[model samples]
Target chain A: MKAVKVILVLFLLSILVIGQSYAGTIKIGAVLAVTGPASFLGAPEAKTLEMLVAEANSKGGIKGNKLELIVKDTGGNPEKAISFAKQLIEEDKVFAIVGPSTSGETMKIKNIAEEAKTILLSCAAAEVIVNPMAKYVFKTPQNDSFAVIKIFEQMKKMGISKVGVVSSNTGFGKAGKEQIEKLAKDHGITILLSEVYDKAASDLTAEVTKLKANNVQAVINWSIEPAQAIVLKNAKQIGLNVPMFQSHGFGNIGYVKAAGPAAEGVIFPAGRLLVAETLADNNPQKGVLLQYKKDYEAKFKEEVSTFGGHGYDAFIILKAAIEKAGADKEKVRDAIEGIKNLVGTAGIFNFSDKDHNGLDINAFEMLTVKDGKFIVLK
Target chain B: MNTQLFFQYFVAGVTYGAIYAIVAIGFNIIYNTTGIINFAQGEFVMLGAMTAVTLNNFIPLPVAIILAVIITIIIGALIEILFIRWLVSPSVLRMIIITIGLSIVIREVALHIWGDGIYALPYFTGTALKTLSVGGVFISPQILWVLGICSITVIILNLYFKYTLMGRKMRACASNRSAARLCGINAKNMVTLSFMLSAGIGAIAGCIVSPITYVQYDSGTPLAIKGFTVAIFGGLGNSMAAVVAGLILGILESFSIWLMPTAFKDVISISILLFILFVKPSGIFGNKEALNLKEF
Candidate 1:
């Protein structure tokens, strides 16, 4: 009886010691699409978060507390994201959740995080994620509206008022169409033609040919993946010679390469990561962007995409929030809202009650494909 | 619409349709011999396109194309020998489920090997296949290549099946497997040959379309669906019907975009297909007698 009591007392003491040590660590939850069709988005994001956490912990972490990042793969599915968000908030008791890589998944889990009263710093680009003032949610990527506005600004500078829009039938495409339609008139632009194609359509020649017939000055395509690249190739094939602009979805160099020579002179709006080297010395995002680019490339042996940049900014913003507010969820939420002038790979973030993204049209840089690579359009 | 607009739409439809037709022909080959719709037909197309793009870095384009086709043929044959041959007694339902499962496996394996980046092959002629402007309608040379290759493939297949001894044995197995086996023809060997032939054709189709569409690991299913639709419309195992049906589907899909919103393209095509099936239960060119036979 005496030996049994002694062993139980020692086990309790060990539990107390382990618990005390882990109590000082901050836990951040991430839901990324690491293996699904959107693995392109999730793979880089997971890498970015892992790298940032390791780097911070190596340097003694934020405010001298060790950082623990728990990443879950959603495989780009919304149901998976919601379940993961619940696990992070209810079971793991993370102070904050950083991502559910795609916009659709982020929206699906927004209420969960809000109910849990934990901050969600999403890496996805949809405007709906941040608009309407979701108190507990913030995002790093420039909103789709900002991407549209940036494209329009470039169009205005070139004196191209009449434009044609070819958007995909998917959520991203449909949302982009709405933004373009809503903002075009405000920008003194007239949409000559607007059409939505199947995201999986093998060819868009008919659509391009129709746009050319309508005599639009420029064409804007909004979608992800092969659709964006295929439109450019189809335009070249059917001789739609006007300037073509794509949404931020065209950020990846792989798309540019896929379009081959057809990608030349086609412009799009994207984050600063693609043009990190070309950013001027005084640019706010330059230093951090360069460091991230070098570190990521060195470790992964692949070029850094803006999707990864979004992940990097998520942790960066969270680190700042944690530094100011400690590990309290409510305080972290307020800290995240209070963050301002935080230079990140996406842009300088300035959060407020009215704005969660804290980014405007300026967050995007107008980039054009030149010689199978992205070049900043001066 | 003006002549130029019509021509532009026509060219677009034909180009797109030709890809479907080639895939349809591939389906016809396997379906004719085994009475099974090789659901992995599209994977063969994807594999061919992916392999060619991968090989182009090391070898010349022409050599890469040939090698890619050969590789697909070998893969098809291997699939037959290893998986399909082991089926206790092949039923259409069982064969279909197996092919579907195989397709998923192939796509996942492809993802692991190549990653998920979209890849495109260069235009075969070195430069962007110059768009030939005829009276105001622009047509890409790639379109011509697609149409040309598709037609040649159909003609060569027809000639081979009609003339070659090995092809005859395969046809004999298709018409009556038991009789062919009784006559000392190896029905299983003929099935294997048919798979190889279909895979080769599907691979070539992939190579032809890759420059325009850009091939991804997941591209096979859509291509397969489109191809299956074309095959059904043309009468399942009829080569000539496949070509005509492919052209018709492609042109209609293109022209419909002008008449209605782009979203209705699939709706319009599938509706037309349904209407045709409603009118003639045995597709446009499919022989009812052949379809009635359980073996073929």
Candidate 2:
């Protein structure tokens, strides 16, 4: 009995020490694909959150407490994400969590977030992640359906009727193609062909040949950058003179550089233009963009891509929402949902009850590659 | 929907099958010599592909390929000496777990160094994609490359094993490490050599693939699994059989794409492997009684 008491006293003393050392910080846990193929998204999400947290503290923090971001890398795997979410919740005692940058990874942790009543702001853009609608869950990232909707609007404006969409057989690609097909019909666009590429595909000529024979005016590419670029190169090689309509993903200059001159006239609905001249002065978010651009460019010492813009947006939205909520969990959730006309590096992000995504069609500034640089379409 | 479509899918499957076969060869070679199934072998493909792309961005294709291979060979050897050398005598399960953990670490390190974003790599020569029509079924140059590489790798590896003294010593080390040590052969070097060779092959696979399919950091794991499965089905330690096994999986998956949804392709392969394990534990080309739980 005496030994048990002595042990209990030591445990209490250790707890006191731990509590004393790290206290008064509003902890927000984040899960990102920090070490996988999707690290492209997670790295930015992680970096953006840090910048936002630092900036928030510099301005006296949210309601006088510093914002602490506890982050984990999901590595683009869904199974690993569930465990990491649990770790952040139980071990870290975080106030809320953000993460699992891909839709596939985000889907794995949705139930855990619901059971824990922890607010999860997912970065993946898959429509199915939140289709069933979990409470305490919202996404700042755009979904496939919205992307398709944005692309459909552009297709309608381009006056192109006959369309061909080639997508990978993965869940994300299939869903996008399905939504594009449904929206294409609603938008009065004729579907010329629908093709599928193997996930392990290196060449796509056999698939492209069928699409090429269809006499489509434009091709909607719905695959990751590598396969998508393969399609563009092969299509151009086969002398298919159709305009290619790409998803927001093709906005990366790396894709353009990979496709070389063949990527010219390829139109995509970009979430943000990292180096657009328009955002420097006259744009509404000029101040924010200017600050973010200055910091990001200085750190990485390379030109920022649209992905960096996403990083800038994720962190800013969280900081602003936290400030408005004054550290109250319910209030912060409310603040995030109630965010109206909140200017971000991406654009003026306005969120409401009906819409979870803050950005709209206007946010997707249409752009094309001209002379190796993105020429913003008027 | 028709026979022509069937033929198209079949041809597609054959092309894929060939690539997996080449991937499997690396698995077979490493397993044959080391008795340790290195999971990061797939990362060699990622590394190789990424390296080729990095090099190709600045230099010519031939030079890029050469540089990619050399870098991968060095990486493979270093990984063996650094990580696998200590785990050489552990249980196969431990080795497998260690390799998977190492793979995770490798992928994370890759992610940190190379930020996420899908990169598009062009096929050889940065040339226009060319297709051949054989008997009304269309085949692309990429398929030809995949098939050509696998064939050459199989023949060369088989010849080396049969002819070269170093290759014979490798076989000896794989078969009887104690005996090989008694014969004054550097058994440790043999293990490292196997890793280097496997890495070179994996690099070639990656280089050819990135230009064809597009690679990301996480893409290596699935390919690694597929490669392991092909080696197992064909005979885990049989390099030549790995080639056949890779092709078999590719063609089977290609046909299955038409018969079933592509999402369950891995499931189908898993089921097939399970059946094979239950009925024929020795695999296609392996010894029936070689199932002893032994050390490297």
Candidate 3:
């Protein structure tokens, strides 16, 4: 009887010690598409988060407390994302959740995060993720509308009033198409022809010919698929010599290589990360962008993509919020909204109650493919 | 549409048609001998192109293509020997399932090896931007290469089947397996030879078209579906009819984009396939009596 009582007392004391140590750590949950079709987005995002967390932990973590990150790979499935979001909220009880890489998965769990009052900083590009403005749901990627506005603003400078839009039938392409149509008229532009082609289309000659028939001043191809590279090649083959505009999806150097010589002189709007070396030395984002690009390339032995930048932006934003709020979920949510002029790889973010994405048209830089490489459009 | 635009669409249709016809010929070669669809036919094409692209890094383009086709032919022979040789007259459904399973295995293995990156070979005559213009119509030189190689492949295959002793033995096995075995011919070896022949042709087609269509790990399935449609429309075992059927389907699909949205292009082609199946089960050129004699 005396040994049993002593054992019980010692077990209680050990539990107290373990529980006390865990109390100072901030637990963050991330659901990303690490293996499926969207792995292009999620793989880099996951790597960036893992690198940043390790760096932070080595530096004594945020505000003298260690950070515990839990990453869940959804393989770009919304159903898995829903289950993971619920599990992270109810079971793991993480203070905050960072991503569900693609826009579809992010939208699937937006309400769950809102109801649970856990902060969700999504790395998706869809405007719908934040336009409704759930108090607890914020996003890191720049809005599709901002990208569209930047493209239109450049078109206006070139005196191009009529354009043809071709997009793939994917969520990213469809969302970009809607934004382009919605903002074209506001920018004094007229869309002569709009077509949605299959994402797996082997040839896009017929579609490009239709744009030629319409006599549009410029052609805008909106897709993240290899079909977009086909579009560039087909348009050049048919001798449609007008300027071509691609979506931010053309940021990958692989696409330029796939299109080969045809990719030259093609323009697109993208984040500053692609042109990080060309930015002025004193620019606020230059240092952050270069540091991230250098660190990511060195660590992964691969080129740094903007998709990873989205994940990087989410972490830094969350770090700033946690620094100010100090592990209080409600306070972190408010602190995120109150963050202003935070330098990130995507852009300088200024969050407010009315806006959760916090990026403007200026966030996009008009980039062109020149000599088979991305350069700032002069 | 203007005459130039009409011609432009026509050229596009013919380019894709030649590709489909080649793949359909691959299907017919296997279906003729084994009575199996060999759904992994498309993977042969993918394998050929991917191998050539990798080999092109260390060797000249023409030599790389030849080596890739030979490699794919060996793989085809191995697949038949390992998977189909000991089946002892397997049911048609069983063969179909096995081929489908094999295709998935090959695709996954390719995904692992290649890492899902889209790759294309350099154009043979000129760069991607170079085009030959006749009147107001612009023609990509790569399209001409696709058409010429397809025609040459079909001609060479026809000659081989007509004049070669080995080809005659394979045909005998295809016509009457038991009788051919009694006549001192190895019917099983003929099946392996048919697989190699089909794989070789598929690889040739894959290499010529990779410059225009681009090659990826998963690009094979869609090509396979289109090729299967052409095969069915042309009569399952008739290679010559496949050429006509492929062109008709391709031209119709391209023109359908003019009347409807581009998203419905595949819908129009597949609907034609359904209509053909419902109206004439033996296909446009298939003899009803001959189809009745064969086992599906």
RMSD of each: 2.4, 5.1, 3.1
- How far residue A114's Cα lies from its native spot in candidate 2, in Å, is 7.2
Show the colliding residue pairs in model 3: none
The DockQ scores of all candidates, in the order shown, are 0.70, 0.26, 0.65
The DockQ leader among the candidates is 1
Runs with alpha carbons beyond 4 Å of true place in candidate 3: A1-21, B81-89, B162-165, B168-191, B293-295
Chain A TM-score values, per prediction:
0.95, 0.91, 0.96
lDDT of 1 by residue, B247-287 (tens): 99999998988887788889977897898779875688877
What TM-score number comes out for model 1?
0.95
Which ranking of candidates, highest lDDT first?
3, 1, 2
TM-score ranking, best first = 1, 3, 2
lDDT of 1 at A150: 89
User: TM-scores of all models?
Assistant: 0.95, 0.80, 0.93
Of models 1 and 2, which has the larger lDDT? 1
Estimate, for each residue in A203-281, the C-alpha lDDT of model 1 and write its tens digit: 8888888897799999999998699988887887787889999998899889888887888999998988899888788
Which is the winner by TM-score between candidate 1 and candidate 2? Answer: 1
Report how far off residue B117 is in candidate 3 (Å): 2.7
Ten contiguous residues minimizing lDDT sum, candidate 1 chain A? A16-25
Worst ten-residue run, lDDT, model 2 chain B? B120-129
